[model samples]
Every structure is written in structure tokens, then in C-alpha cells.
Target: MKPAPASAPFAGPFALATLSAPDGPPFPALVTPDGRTVDLRTALGDPQLTTRHLLEDWPAVLPRLRSLAHDDTVERGTSAGLRVHAPVEPRQVFQSGANYRQHVIDLHVAHRAPGDDRPEDERRAEAAEIMDRRAREDLPYVFIGLPSALTGPYDEVVLPAWAEQPDWELELAAVIGRPAYRVGVAEALEHVAGYTIANDLTDRAGVFRRDMPQIGTDWLRGKNAPGFTPLGPWLVPAESVADPGALRLVLKLNGETMQDESTKDMIFDVARMVSYISRTARLLPGDLVLTGSPAGNGIHRGRLLRDGDVMDASITGLGTQRTRCVTEVTP
Candidate 1:
């Protein structure tokens, strides 16, 4: 055997910590704010480098950064501070549908509740009424989207002219760190390099059929637009998160909280999703899997993204990613 192709820079906890903007080559190595990108990758790869040695490399390379706390530097510098690129410019994007019970209930109510602005109490009562009446009657929906739609942090999500109601979704996306087929749940996290944030943009006009119920087409149309998958900030190496399933996820529109909840809200958690998704496709390093969004999306309110809208999405322990929207001639 040729040693299984060397497995792309697998490193220890301290090695993982050294990532900086513009660090790798061909593409500029990830750069640090105080100007040190060289040490991140080298430290990760060097067998002689320990956690303490890696810390020494930073202060020697960029003295100003030495004072910043490790957690602060990683957040303020790597995950939160770096000028990001998409998590992966892969060939495909996977979306999970009706993945949360609350999302399903929201859809049911949005489709059936009479169109009217009701008092907060009335809305609460109606929600309770709907919950009492709900039943499970659909498949576990999953869909595909093009990679061309992906844009990185600080990038503009260009709205298509054909888009009548573009919506924002705060989804947790995983960057596959290795290749595996029929991987067990116990081995799934090993395949994940880290997690990043994504906006699963939706084009609502293509989502529904006249007044008929929302179907896969609505979900697909709402998801597949150029510049739709705005991702990054940076990949917070998995070791940093105590439990991926427990992180709190939140999204804001121009600084106003829009979606706020925990990753614990998932109907299917991270381990199951990874094992399930990989059963069908052998996930390779750099391939991304978007773990699905929670309820509180704009489409539920008949509201959707418009020009000049700003979106801020974050997963606790994973740094926040932000983007601005602009209208572009739909090509």
C-alpha cells in the first residue's frame, strides 16, 4: 500500500490551533492580523512541536499576537477575524428537509392558518392548536444544489432577478476531513475536520405550486441561486467543541435577532447525519455537508431577503459569519 495517500495534514490539538488566513499555498496561507501565517501549518505538521513550542513560535513570529489569549486569538483571529473563503468550493451541496418538528409545524401552520395578523396570544393559541392536530406524513427530504452558489464571508449574496422571495437559512455545515464508506457513527466525527456556518438561501417562487402545499421544488428553488450559500469565517477544529449537538445557533438580519436556538433542536443530530449522508456518498476531505436549519425562517412570515439585507449567523464555539445582500442581473 502507498500509505493511503498521506491523509492531508492530520495534526494534534496544538497543530489544529495554528490555522491563519492565507496560510496554505497556491492560495495564500491564512494570515493572522499581526502578520503570521507561516507558523500555523508548520506547527501543525512538525512532530517536534508540542503545544508549548507552538505557542513559542507565535510570539517569536509575531510578538504583538503573543499577548492575546489562545482562545481569544483563535476566535478574534482565526474563526471570527480571518477574511474567509467558502468552506469548500465543492461540486455539490446537500440540504436536509423537514429536519425539525418545529419547522414542519411552522410549514403546516403557514400553509393552513388563515391569512391574518393576529394578537400574540392568538398566535400562541393557534400554534398550540396546530401542535395538537399534527401528524407525521412525509419522507425524510434531502436535496442537492450546485457549488457555484457558494460565496465566502464578507462576500455579497447576489439576488437573482427571477427570485421573488429569497430567504435566509442558518445551517451548520461540516467540512469532511477524510474519505470513508459505510463509516460507523462512532467513527463519523473523525471524518469531520471542523464546522462552519452557511446561509441556505431559498427562492420561494419556485417553492410552491399556485396555492398548493409547499413541496420539494419550493425547497430546491429557495435553495439554488447564485451566491446563495454564503459560508465561512473559518473552520473551528472539532476538538474545540465539547459537543457539536449542543451548540447554540443564532441568525440575525441587519443586527436584529431572526433565528435563535440550539443545535440540540435537530431532529437528527450530527453523528446520525454524518453516518447517514456517507452511506450514500463517500465523503472526501473538503466536501461539505450542511446539517439543516431550524425554524423561525423568513418564509414562515411571508417575509424574505431583499437587497441591502445583512445576515449574521453563528454556532457557539464556532465563530460567527456575516454577509451583505446585493441584487445582480440573474444570469
Candidate 2:
């Protein structure tokens, strides 16, 4: 792990931290709204408090812990000094595709066939109709990602030599706190533990299957490179985030803003994504369901990633992340 200079000013009532001392091992911590921390093990009355262990028992012990947040006797330190790690090791990570109407519109409108003569308004209308059909049919394109691809919020991303068009996708990730199966959309948000920011780095060139055109996208080869997912500096408890749909998400390359949009632009909300996924299989306590990204990606800007580039991402009330790009140095 390396130092990521960006710090998140958390406005949530309660938050979680998976971190260590400047030179120590990883452990779970309880973070306050003022950026102070108490070891979760001590607060939870257990000597062993791995992130997974805490999350697995959240549904049972949340009340006791919520009460502990008010105790002034617990030892506290500034969270700014701590070396934060990825909040949890998810058993499954589900990513949504084409869930942002404007993002899909940018992808479709930026590149048109030479002979095509469709007007901009007509093209946008067609795209809007497609999103409408998706919501009406309750069909969301969800894909699985390897847990091993995940890294801390500020970790270095090693761009492969073969990946010529590495891109950044800043998204809102919902952490599952309870076991859920076939849950209704009305009650799906209850299954969420908290919220965190994620930079879903991608290799644009490999998004489609050129050799096997009929197979569609090849996410494994294109998106799952090591350190492809740079996750949170903190986890704000679900209750603290009143409305996930109203939050603003942003991403910057170096110091220039690339993506700027609100969660309101999403074609399907967080509850719908969770409810749709649980219908096919059981959702575990630490599973991550990533809502899709908005527009202003590198492809739309006509500028892809390069060696030594730095990316900074933030979501309102969630947190901030800073990552530097480097070419993979070893085989």
C-alpha cells in the first residue's frame, strides 16, 4: 500500500474504517463523523474484528454498536493518520452496464456511421426509448468481477502495455450487509450496509469481442486486470446516507474534471439493482453491487490514459480517492 494524498470529509453520522497504523497490519475501525476512529474490535467487545467478521455479524449486533457510537470513553484518534485499506473483501462483485442514460448516449452519439443521417434529437429519443424498455422489462445488465482485482482507494494502477486505451469510471458502490434472496424492490435498500466510492478502471479497447463478434463483451480480459478497482477510504453507514439517488459523483484526471453528474441520472436506482440481482441467487453480507457511471469518459473526451497519469474521484458524502498510473514493470 502507498500514500494517496486526497482526504475525505465525511458528513455521515457514522462510518466504518478498515485500516492499520502507518506501518502495521490491517484491522477494522469505527470512524466518527468528525474523522476520529476507535478500533472496531474494542468497540464491538471482540478481540478479533476483521472487516468480514464485523459485516457478517452486522445484522445481529448493529443495535449494540449503534449505541456504542455515543460512548465517550472509547479511545479515539484522528482517521487522517491511519493507512486505510479496502473496507471489505466481497464474495461477489456485480457491476451494472448501460445503466446511465447520458453515458450510453455519449457512447452512441460520439461515433456515428459515415452514411448515417439521423438528427441529434432523434438519436437521443431512440436511446431514451431503449432505457425505458429496460426499466419496464426489469432487465439490468449485470456482470461478475473477480474479488482479487480489488485494491485500496489510493493504490497504484499498473497499466498493461497491451492496454492502449485505459479509462476511468467513477461509480457509486452499495455494500450488502445482510443475506437476501428474491427481495422486493420496496425493501431492497434495507439489505445495504453502507456506501463507498469506486474507480472502475477499464481498458476500452478490449470491451468488445472482436475475434468472436457474436460473443459480445469480454469483461474478464478487458476490465479485471489487477488493481482495476480502486475502492474506498471510508464506508458511510447506510442509515447515514438518506438518499443515495441524489448524490453527486465526480472524477478528475490530474486536476481537470472529467465526469460530473448526479445519481438521479441513473436509469435504475440502487434498490432496483439489488432486487434484480437477488432474484437469481443469494446475496452475501459483503457483496458489492456497483451502479453504472455517467458521461464525460476518456472515450468521449478523446483522451485515454497514459503512463504516470493520476486520477482523483469523489462522490458526495461517500469519500474521495487518488490513484497514479504506472506501466506494469514486471512479467
Model 2 is weakest, by summed lDDT over 10 consecutive residues, at 1-10
| Tens-place lDDT digits, model 2, residues 1-331 | 4543434466555678788887888888877766677887776677766887877877776776676678898887766667778888899999998889899888777655457799988887888888899989989989988888888887888898888789999999999999889999999999999889888888988988778878888899878998899999778788878899999998999999999999999989999999999999799998899999999899889998888888889989877888899998866
After aligning candidate 1 to the native by TM-score, how far in Å is the CA of 70 from where it should be?
Answer: 9.1
Off by over 4 Å in 2: 1-8, 110-122
Q: Cα lDDT for residue 237, model 1? A: 54
Global Cα lDDT for candidate 1: 0.62
C-alpha lDDT score of every prediction, in listed order? 0.62, 0.85
Q: For candidate 1, which ten residues in a row score worst on lDDT? A: 1-10
Candidate RMSDs in order: 10.1, 2.2
